[model samples]
Target chain A: MLSVDIRKTLGAFQLQTAFDAPEGVTVLFGRSGSGKTSVVKSIAGLLTPASGRIALGARTLFDDGSRINVPVHKRRFGYVFQDSRLFPHLSVRDNLCYAARVSDRGGRSPDHVADLLGISHLLDRRTHALSGGEAQRVAIGRALLTEPDMLLMDEPLASLDGPRKAEILPYLEMLRKETGLSILYVTHNMAEVARLATHIVLVEEGRVVRSGAPDDLLTDPDMVRLLGIRDAGAVLSAAVTAAPEDGLSELAISGGRLFLPAVEAPVGATLRVRILAQDVILSTTRPEGMSALNILPVRVLAVRRGDGPGVIVQLQAGHDRLLARITRRSADALGIAEGTECYAVMKSVAVSQTDIAVGLQSGL
Target chain B: MTDWLGPEEWQAVLLSVKVSFWATVLSMPLGLICAMALARGRFLGRDVLNWLVHLPLVLPPVVTGYLLLLSFGRRGPVGSFLYDTFGITLAFQWTGAALAASIMAFPLMVRAMRLAIEAVDPRLEEAAATLGANRVRVFSTVTLPLILPGIIAGAVLAFAKAMGEFGATITFVSNIPGETRTIPSAIYAFLQVPGGESSALRLVAVSVVIAIGALILSEWLSRRVAKRISGA
Candidate 1:
């Protein structure tokens, strides 16, 4: 676990944040200029906080009271920046081995890391010759070869386009699952937060507004304002129950089996599916003869009204939590409130391939 | 090549190459240090140091030579100290000619190297540090290789300038046959006597060839390193 409590003054902005990253993927989620990067830089020792204590596991990395500040190199945390800062002078192979060679400690071989990141063929290529996605992958491989105690990624996928992001997301998921290394990933992308974050730290104006498991924080109606109501959603853990037929695959969730766009995972493979709040429709009674294929019996956990005409309703569906953004008039007519019984209906085609992602493996 | 010129002319050509080679080689380490300091250091007297490094470039070569003669001539403070300590002599010798050439060439060398060092991105060094490299390792692994082409360019420019150095060489070391008579001084000597224009012309041609060759070499070397860096 990495603990961070730092206060810094940059120009007119004041950054005061404190959070703990456990042995899973802890995401620092925030909009730009929110001091998310500052927090990560503080942990990497690239930026010093005015007064704070930062500890990783049993070792103290930084403490202003004790006047102890470890330099960046000795901190031994692999950092991947938003831009792929590969040495233009080195081949992909050399860049991957740079950390290992400089630290004079052998960890994974370059070939092995390249294979894991699907960059084996690019080993001999120069850094400038790589595409954006390929370069980012090589950057990740370079970081991993250090065999660091933890990995720090600051929006590693932000520079890539949609297809490119899709290319690297699976590797990121695999890295966390295979290494089980504590990763502090910083980004503002909602899909990435839903897909990769095992733990979420919502940062606003240089402060941590909330920090908790993705299931709870993502579904919390109060967090919708911070998460951007349009992108706010819930991640439901489910196992593949059947192969694709008619372009839809069946996944067994706690509430019931759900049919979504064809998921590439094999039957019995568990994954997380993100259902946007805007995509869910609430009805007090089960609607008959409807095109929507999913209807789960749920009890209203909370009804939160914003200043706009919409109301965010949090629903408890069996053992999982779901959220629906309904119009104020619809909520009034349906009498949706805490403990109100309803059925959360969702169109089968609303969830796209980007919404389905690999969740944290049990006990990892 | 020897049959094309008289023995004295050939000797002058060889002496010029020798002086310029030593001048460029000897001054490189100091040149690199000064360039890095000027490019990255923020300490006190940095501006003064920058001005001092460029003084020889703007000052009249004769005045710069006089200053060198006063400080480094035999029986002078630094010259005497070296003589008493090591029994080494530089004034009126080939070594003094190399020293004058290097002094005249210092500004060009430092400017080229400084530009190159300034062009390097500090972010790359930070990335290296985050990857477990200390300050020295970051410089050696990332900074040095990136600035190598610039260093080569500086060395070549200094070499060309040293090959053409005349005013300072004459004042500091004076002309001496087979000792300090580099091509430029030899050309002057040939022009002072009747029926010596052909020899001066031959030495001039030799200097031009050497200068052009150095430029070509620098260009090729820089391109090769750049291609390796940018992969283009």
Candidate 2:
């Protein structure tokens, strides 16, 4: 477990945050200028806080009361920045082995790391010759070779294009599952939060507003306003039940069988699917759907009204909580309130390929 | 080529090369230290140190030599202390000439190196530190390799400047045939005689070749190092 409670004042921006990260991936989710990066930097010892204590398991990394601020190199925490900070003078292989060579405590070989990141073929190439995605992969590999106590990633995918981001997310997922190293990932992108976050810490204006498992916080109606109502959604864990047919694959969730776009994972593999609140249509009764494929029987858990005409309706479908963004008129007409029964009508095509995350069942 | 010049003229050529070589080689470590301090250090007296390092570039070479004589002469404070403690003297000796040349060349060396150090991204060093590299390791592995081309350029510039050094060398250490007489001093001595024009011309040719050769060599070395660093 990694515990961080730090307070820093940079000009007018005063940041105070406290959070705990267990062995899984804990994502610091916030918009730009929310001080998420500052938290990560403080954890990595890149920026010293004015006051607080930080510790990893039994080791105290920083403490103002004790005046025991461990230096960055001695902390043994791997950090991957937004930009791929590979040394230009070094080949990919040398960059991967840099921390190992310096620390003389390499836990993994360069060849093994390269293979894990799918960069074995590019080891001899110069960093300048690599594509953006490949360079990031090498950067990740470089960090992993150190065998750090924890990994700190500060929006590593923010600089890449869509296709490039798609290319690197799988490697990150694999790292999370295979390494079992506690990771602190920071990003403002909601899609990234839904896909990567096992635990989510919501940061706002240098303060942690709320934090919990992705399933709980994402489905809470009170958090809709903070999570960018349009991007607010719940992550549903399901296992692939059938192979892809007609560009759709069937997955079994606690709610019911969900057919989404062709997920890359094979049958029997569990996956996390992000359902956007805006994409879900709430109906009072199970109406005969003409074209929409999914209509699950649900009971309204809570009704949250935003400043606009839209209201976020939280529903319980079997054991999973789902959110639907419906206007005031629709909510009034459907009589949607706490304990009201409804059917969440969702078109099968609304869920994009990017919304699906291939989660490893056992590791999670 | 061996017999193209007399023994005295050859002595001047060899001695000049020797003085300039010592000047450049001996001053390098200190030059690098001063350059790093000027570029990255944030202590008090940083501005004063910067001004002091550049004083030789702007001051009259004769004045610089005079100051050296007053401060480092045998009877002077540093000079007398060295003589009494270590039994070393630099007055009118060949070593004095090398000292003069190095002082004259120090500014150029420091300037080139400082610019190179400034051009390096500090972020790379921070990344190395986060990757388990201590300060010494970061400097050796990242900072030193990145600034190697600049160091080479600075050394070569100082060498060239030392080779052509005239006013200070002549003022600090008087011309001695086999001891202190460098290429410029030799050319001056040869020109002072009635039938010494040809010898002076030969020495002039030698100085010009050395200066141009140093420039070209520095340029080539810097370009090669830069290319390698950029991964070309």
Candidate 1 regions exceeding 4 Å error are: A358-364, B223-231
| Candidate 1 residue-wise lDDT at A351 | 66
Off by over 4 Å in 2: A362-364, B224-232
Q: Record all residue pairs in model 1 with backbone atoms less than 3 Å apart, i.e. clashing.
A: none
Candidate 1 C-alpha lDDT tens digits along B1-232:
8899999999998898899999999999999999999999999999999999999999999998888889889878999998899998888999999999999999999998887888787888989999989999889989999989989999999999999999999999999989999999999999999999999999999888989998898778666666655545
Worst 10 residues of 1 chain A by lDDT: A355-364
| Candidate 2 lDDT (Cα, 0 to 1) | 0.88
- In the predicted model 2, the residue pairs found to clash are none
What value does the interface RMSD of model 2 take? Answer: 1.7
Candidate 2 per-residue C-alpha lDDT over A128-228 given as tens digits, one digit per residue, 9 for 90 to 100: 89998999999898888888888999999999999999999988888987888888999989998888888889999999999999899999999988899
Error of 1 at A100 (Å): 2.7
> First chain TM-score in every candidate?
0.97, 0.97
Q: After superposition, how far is residue B19 of candidate 1 from its true place, in Å?
A: 1.3
The model with the greatest lDDT is 1
